[model samples]
Target: METTIYHYALCVSLTLMLFFSYRFFFGRLPDSELYRPYRQSRRLMGVALLELSANYMVHFFITPRAVCPTIAILMNLCTYWLSVWLFGSAMMLLLDREWVSRRRFVRHIVGWVAYCLITLVLWFLLPSRVSLTALPIVLAIVFMAYAVRVARKVFLTFRRTIRRLDDYYSDDGAAYIRWMSVFTYWAVFFGAGQGVFTFVPDRYVFVWIISAIPFYTYLYESYSNYLLLYEKATDILDKSNDADAADEEQQTAQNPSQSVADNVNCELNARPQLVMSHDQEVALERGIKEWIDKEGYTVGGLNIADVARATTTNRTYLSAYINTHYQMTFREWVNMLRLDYAKRLMRDNPELPVAEVARQAGYLSLSYFTKTFKDAEGVTPGKWCR
Candidate 1:
């Protein structure tokens, strides 16, 4: 009797989370900010949660059938498949790209996922003991192969996204990579727990679902916050792949741009390999110095795109030049300038409050400024002030 009540409680809680969390990413985005990859991720997560709720309903609420050996295995398989297919794949988009195409994303990840699912589904129809026995071996291989897949997909996306963030704005979502890393490790633990509980006694399954409610809540909140903060950068991340992104994307990487990149494969550090000629490079460098001398970096939320116009270059060329010349990302370069000026302010105006110093240095967030200052100088601004 108590067990039945407990099962009911668990199902109700999971259902509630599924219902309320919809608004996290599904709220109306502006027409201009309706980024495809971001929307795709939100849709994938919504589907994943729906799948999770269904599996949990059977696994927890319908405990008698759930405990049957075949049902238990099937339920676990469903959970595992959803984890890798929908949620994992959602997080893996736009990797290795200043911009990417939809076909490239499908080729990079969805193809392999489809292959694995096909193999698993086909092997399941055979009731042979050999097929059953070999299932664990196949899963081990899948896990190993998918490890490489995740590295290629998720890690590359992180690298490109964070670098792009660094190339553009200091206060954007570069720091969210750390949160994503945490979420990923937690996901592995949660997925493993779901599998393990299928074999354990039934009541403990509640623990995974109960904990999962909060986990999904955190995931939704973090991702939504990232979308809000870095709306512009995320919008442009997949612009080359989106059809509706005006006429330029129609003449996109698939034709001229992709061909140029593939043929050259040139060292990114080599300036001569760039499309820009010697005089253009000299003029751009001079223009950059003039912008710096004018204290353009002191503006709040200054980004590489803003300076790109000043220097008469696109952000691609501007980012490349900053990376090669300063040997740092645009964010790092900008922060260095900001910090040098901040140090001078602290030294000269020792009586000034830390918040005043941060604001004068063009830092909008005091905590972020303090963290950045501490990271670079091994001391907080307050200590540096003293």
Candidate 2:
């Protein structure tokens, strides 16, 4: 009865794996250049899942008692290593594309090859039963160590990237980094669970099946989130491109000679703008300040383009104006406004929670808001209020 139950669970897990693997390979993946790395990672994950399912099927269903234990052990070891290789490749591409070059990829391949060759030679020397039973435990321990190391490295890199950004709420690059961090954490958790189950194959087969349901469910949900994020990123890019094109056309229509000069200056000098007369500059600055004051746009994910659109100005001109008048980049200027607003909110409603104050101040993340507040004011929001 126990064997029957385990067999049924394996069948169900295998079916689900195959279905998702098919979806991953043939599903409507995002076509935007921004999603290229994400798409590649999904493909690698699909291949790994397929190999893992095959490994389980062979171990449970195909390996008969008459079959040589050495052959079964070797096959399982190969599949285990292959799955790890595929996952590691996917993560490397996702977290650090620069590190996924041909040289690094080849190095990884060589390392895996050497490990497998050494293990196989050892397997032949050991008794078949010992090799079958003990080798998995050794491999599981090594894999768990690798997973923990990789997870820590990925998390630190992600945290550093976020800290370096002035306005993470509006930066898609920051969002991608955060998402990769979540993926790394999820993969490590599930991979560790699977590794632990490998040690107690007799007692944990049913538990493994139950755990796999949530594991694959989370995997699918993350894939959906990736799709949604891709769509949003592409939409933002399209709008930015359209806005730039429209701005150029309007400028050319209004002042053909000045526009031509500006284009030439932009190509040669890297920062070209029609010299704004004092009156024009003041008017633009006033318009921006009034719009921000009235609309509270600074409370959330404000960008130069958004402000430019609100003020009926070009983004380039608006950015330059902010830089010249405020002595800061657009991001810094927005954060300055947000920080001031948050301080006032805290002072007026002292009873409100710091998290609520952060939200009202347009911060998507409370931890980030606190860090920014401390950087600017030398005290946390809670401390400042007191």
lDDT of predicted model 1? 0.64
lDDT tens digits, residue span 11-48, model 2: 88888888888887888975778778778878988998
Residue 59 error, candidate 1, Å: 1.6
Q: Which whole-number lDDT from 0 to 100 does residue 164 have in model 2?
A: 30
Off by over 4 Å in 1: 1-13, 20-40, 64-67, 89-137, 140-152, 173-181, 192-207, 223-259, 262-284, 312-315
Cα lDDT tens digits for candidate 1, 143-239: 5455445534565567656765676675644664556666666666665444454444455555544677777877777677767654545544444
Q: Which candidate is the best by TM-score?
A: 1
